[model samples]
Target: MSASSQSEPRLLFISGSSREKSFNKKLAKLGENIADANGIKGTFADLGDYPMPIYNGDIEVNDGPPDNARKLKALMEVHTGIFIASPEYNASFSPLLKNAIDWVSHIKDGGLQVYRTRVFALGAASPGGMGGLRGLAQLRLVLENGLNALVLPDQFVVPKAMEAFDDNGHLKNKENQETFKAVIQKLARAAHVLHG
Candidate 1:
């Protein structure tokens, strides 16, 4: 990769839901911690911190994206990989998550760099048996085809997530925890290679 095209060695974690006690949010943080343990620098992205109105092309033509979109784009520019923990809503990812992507997708002049330059890993945590895997399926398709992102093949799912974590947000089951950590480690390794 050319020097200018290579981003810094960092990973980004984003939770599809913005709820304070959301299991998906906790999963994203856990991914970050696991990435750190695996010797990779990481950052957790909060959608709450980057609020914007529902997407509208008229608004974009009139005023461009909200300030938060620019801020999010800047963050994406620094990280070479992304981890997304999506919440299930109506058999798909939450509207909040989709809206965020829609707004960011409107960016031009290298705005789509995040999708093409970085590798993305999709995961989910849900109280249901399906573990939000159904929702993740839609997300992967949208990110890969709609946005043209390079999503990782391996995905992590936390089923019955409400009962899966402890007070510290760590998964109680040893096997599940190990699986989650393994996913993070793989993402770090892939990011390292792609950034070269």
Candidate 2:
């Protein structure tokens, strides 16, 4: 098939980091590079820009979703898949990402379940030995319940993430890069099959 005929699927990459120099952000950027190399269009969405107070149904009932929530919902609608690269805070996902998700879920004018039926892939990075695998596991369960998303079974865990990238923020670990690429490729392929 021609290159145009083989158009790649588009993914919305949600980076769960609020720090300017976050290792998880670097890992998500590396995943974007891998996605580009695999002929997938990846758009990175940083959680830092989308700030919201912790979810409170009573508060939401009084005040509506913020503008950032609307923007994220729009992006989610346009993309075929979502790839989340999260960081472990304590033993769970960063509060920033969790808040963004909460805000996105409150957009009632748009479909109640904006993420439902979408394909999702999960990954995490950390300085710890297990990376953020435990956090990603917990996140998977939450995402499944919230979105009813088609969660991919494969996941990428980048432990000692600071050491895996170079000064320019490119992933230097060949094995991890390969594994990351494979997971994203599988997500794109599955999205195509399920949504085509």
* Per-candidate total of colliding backbone pairs: 0, 0
In candidate 1 the C-alpha lDDT for residue 120 amounts to 90
lDDT of 2: 0.79
Poorest 10 consecutive residues of model 1 by lDDT?
1-10
TM-score of each candidate structure, all chains considered together: 0.94, 0.90
| Candidate 2 lDDT for residue 187 | 85
Q: Candidate 2 residues 1-196, lDDT tens each?
A: 2112334567778889968988888877877777887778887888877777787887778877777778778777777778999998887888888777778876886544566756889988898899999999778877887667678999888888768778877768777778888898998888777654
Which regions of candidate 2 are displaced past 4 Å? 1-8
lDDT tens digits, residue span 146-177, model 1: 98999999999999997999888789998999
Q: For candidate 1, report its TM-score.
A: 0.94
